[model samples]
Target: MLRAENVTLSYGAEPVLEGASLSIEAGQFVSLVGPSGSGKSSLLRAIMGLQEISDGRIETPLQSTDIGILFQDDALLPWRTAIENVSLGLRLNGRDRGRAVAEAEAWLERLGLTGLGRRYPRELSGGQRKRVALAQVLALKPRLLLMDEPFASLDAIVRARVTQDVVNLVESEGIGVLLVTHDLEEAIALSDVVYLLSNGPHAHISQRYSVPIPRPRNLVKSRSHPTFAPLYERLWSDLSDVVDGPRRIRTAA
Candidate 1:
């Protein structure tokens, strides 16, 4: 549903991305994994039209208003209740207040947040807030999802649970996703395609790997698949070569 061809971006004289290309099909999940300075988030910003690309083209059937993004931080309004937060997008779209609330409640329930709708961000746990943020995005019915390490801030257990929930929900809705993450296991487990970037000052997609694993993946059990270890090792080797090298440690964007 979205394609970037030979996209380029830079800050002043230093280029962050150069000739980086990738695509996401309808209902397909793709991920970008790379060192901190490799422009993963910058690529996302470019795709979202938040940053201007210096070269090439980005083609998407969906408009900027149709894309939904979830950031590393949930970015929920502290004063809004969970349901209110979820309903914000619908409200902005001119949905009826009652209908928006009802739909938001249903989505909250779907995300395993049955009774937490009335709670404010301060009252909810970290995971619950993330779910609210997710509901907010899904409420808009985005054709493409742009996630910038949405699970990175959560604890391991919470991250795993939320990740699984995300997979189930997005698959059922047939929404395409382009995720930016440093976690190779998360990328491999959740995405159909993984694109690795070389280290910056000017990073490009150095390799692309297909995850042959089937959908509705068992978060725990899938790790034992014959292909899992080898894929992990291969990705780790490639990633480590960039991050652990003599280059300065730059966290994955």
Candidate 2:
């Protein structure tokens, strides 16, 4: 549903990404992974129209309202109850109060929040807050989801559970996702296609790997898949090269 073609992004004269391109179809989970400073998050901002692109184009048939975003921070209002937070977008978009609340309640239930909807963000655990943030986005029935390391803050076990919840929920909803994460395992476990970006000042998509592991994936069990380790190693090697290429060149010189 979304395509970015040979896109370029910059801050002042310094380019963060150049000639980077990726696409996501309906119900597809695509991931972008690379070392730190590879402009992964900047690419997301470019897609969201939050950052202006200096070259090429991003084409999406859906409007801005059809996109949902989840960041590392939950970004939920502390004072708002879980249900209130989830329903806020709908109400802002002119949905009736009752309908919004009902929809929010349903989404919370889907994400396993259920009776906890009355709790405020502070009262909820980190994982719970992330789920609420997720429900808030999903409640909008967005066609595209842009996630920037949304689960990074959670502990490993919680991250796995929450990641599973995300996978199940998005697949069921047929929402296309473009996730930006440093976690290669998470990418392999969740994505159908994983695109690797080169280390920046002019980062670009260096390689795209189509995951051979079948789904509906069990995040933990999938790691044991025969194809998983090989793919992970290849990705790891590629990322390592991108990260260390300059140093290697200097050493050779």
Candidate 3:
């Protein structure tokens, strides 16, 4: 399991997160939801060691827990081809360049970007670029996938498609995911459990909503199910308290 205890982050003297913590177990798909500036991204970066926590600790099963991160934007290299961007981490890890390219190529094919490998970031659609970035990270074979509102910028249809791609690919790899998203429906559709977070300085675990629905989760079915209205209502209500608290906006718009 990946565990974080009393973890916090701050900029100089200003605390961004304080005593914020959560543990994600193996094979679990979890989502973190909160109002903007709630330090959701900060928490993920701290877990990945990309950012330092000021107060507490984050623990992975091992130092090499194979954590992969997908940012909101495509964040691909402009000069590099799509496949090249995917192979970058491998090359930095000392895989032979040719071998890395071949592996990246294979991942591209697996992620629905086979013939598009030669395209640059500028040449790809927003969805296409995001897919390539995902393919890039997956090539590293990380057992833990961390995504920071990855589909937040996509159109509704593209968001759905990308969510499905991520769900299908991660399930196939037996990779656990910790997704940070503003989209309520996305969290419901993709996560096995939704972790609702409070705003920080003293951020606390607000709620843990086990999706309690069947897998291969279809959003359409989720909206119409017996469990749907009640569960969604509860989540929205609880989240509403936090979202509306202290003069903050509740719904994402």
Candidate 4:
């Protein structure tokens, strides 16, 4: 439902992205992975209209309200209780207070945060807070999700469980996702397709790998899939090449 075609982004005169392109359809899970400073996050910002692109274009039939973002910070309000936080968007969007609360409560329950609604963010564990944040986003019934390392801060175990929860929720809801992450294993485990970005100053998509694993995916079990290791190695090798390519050129110069 969304396409970014030959997009380019620049900060002042320094270009960060050039000819970077990708697309997403309903129920598809897509990821962008690359070295630090490669503009994976910038591409996402451009898609969201939070950052202006210098060239090319992003097209989507969905309105701004149709998109939801989850950042690594979760960005939950420190003062709002869980249910209040989840319902905030609905309330602002003109949903009736009672109806918004009811819908928010339902989303909290769906995300396994049923009894925790009354608690503040400080009262919840990391995983629980992440779920609350997710509930906050998904409660809006967004058509597309944009995640920027949303699970990166959680511990490995919590990260895995929350990742699986995300996979389950988004798949069940048929929402398309564009995730920007530095973790290749996480990318492989979660995405239908992973696009690798070349290193900046003028970064672009370097490779696209279609994940061979089937869906209703278990994050842990996906690692053991027959095709998983080989894909991981190939991605790792390609990532290394892109990271090293600049250094090699510098050395030659």
Candidate 5:
């Protein structure tokens, strides 16, 4: 359960978000999609307390407020092995070192990262690293997971697998997730509710598409579904309006 009410974010004189609102009930997976500079990342950081919202309110259950965040970058410690990296969050949360290591290892196994834990970040491939990163967050058992392009770095096949793993985690844990991504297909494939923001210094929700696909949705099958084509076409059209928006000009005398 997370909600941003009449949210606004500005950088000095420039505004990036205006009256953008989103609500996620427990166990819902929501995607925020928009063109570059649409303020998707800003909205997420604000909700996570990493950025200050210029105005409005963000509310979530206190206990669940310690949300987990996964970024496009794995953000793993280069020197640390996978298991060590995974346990970092738990360690910071006052978990005992031994117990944290054990828990992290268990999560790694669940995500299909068993023996890989001994490898350092540099030794792991991109997909392996992302899974290690995901394992790190999932190990926390966060109530809300904020992801900003979690699959951006992986290849298509890897991305699909990672997406499925993430979906599985969300369902099993029943945690709310707000993911910011530019990929319309990825958003639709993985989310229950998709929010599209128009591009601007202060972007607003241009449209919110609710996916009627049944629970336990499949990314591949959903792509070829009849409704998928129309919905995706519209989402792309909305996003392109901003991505290819007219350039501001300087008037000359």
Candidate 6:
């Protein structure tokens, strides 16, 4: 549903991304992985129209080009309650106030934050806050979701559960996702296709691999599958080559 074709971006004379291409089809889960400074976040920014591309093209369906973004920190406003945060987008889009409240409440419930809707970000735990953040974006009902390490801050148990919730949402709601994550296991578990990017001055996608593991995948069980180790090794080997310095495989959030 969204395509970035040979996209390039620069900060003044410095190039960040070069010839980076990827696509997110309806009901697809795509992940981008790279070392720090590989322009993963920059590429996402360009796709979200938050940054200007120096070259190439981005195309999306005309009717549903609106995209929802979920950042690693969750980006919740300190003064707003959970429901308020979720309703902000709807209200800005000129939705009816009462309907916006109702829809936001429903999204809160869907994201496992039913009674917590009235709680402000500071009052909520990290996972709860992240759930609120997820609801905030999902309530927009955008055609595509751009996630930049949305689960990175959560504990392992919470991240696993949230990942499962995201998988269900993708399957049931048919939302296309292009996720940028440093967590290789998380990417392998959640993505249908994974793209590896080399580090930059001028970062570019180096390889794309299809995840053969079947859908309705139980993240824990999927890891135990015979194919999982091989896939992980291959991706590691490919990523290890381009990601150098102390950064090696550790990318910025």
The prediction achieving the highest TM-score against the true structure is 2
lDDT of 6 by residue, 2-45 (tens): 88999998989988889989988887889999988889998988
lDDT of 1 by residue, 1-253 (tens): 9989999999987788999989999999999999899999999988988999888899988987789999999999998899999998898899999999999999999899999999999999999899999999988989899999998989999989998888888888899999999988888888899999988878999889999888877778778878888999999998888767654445542
In candidate 3, what are the lDDT values of residues 77-155, reduced to their tens digit? Answer: 9999998898898898789999999999998888788799899899999999999999888888888999998888999
Candidate 5 ranges beyond 4 A from true positions: 242-253
How far off is residue 180 in model 1, in Å?
A: 0.8
Alpha-carbon lDDT, every model: 0.90, 0.92, 0.84, 0.92, 0.87, 0.87
Per-residue lDDT of model 2, residues 18-131, tens digit only: 898888999999999998888899889888889888999999999999999999899999989999999999999889999999999998998888899999999999999999
Clash pairs detected, candidate 2: none
Global Cα lDDT for candidate 2: 0.92
Q: Clashes per prediction?
A: 1, 0, 0, 0, 2, 0
Model 5 lDDT, full chain set: 0.87
Better of 2 and 4 by TM-score: 2
Ranked candidates (lDDT, high to low): 4, 2, 1, 6, 5, 3
Worst 10-residue lDDT window for candidate 1 reads: 244-253
Candidate 2: segments with Cα more than 4 A from true spot:
none
Candidate 4, superposed: residue stretches over 4 Å from native: 250-253
TM-score of 1: 0.94
Q: Tell me each candidate's TM-score.
A: 0.94, 0.97, 0.92, 0.96, 0.92, 0.93
**How good is model 4 by TM-score?**
0.96
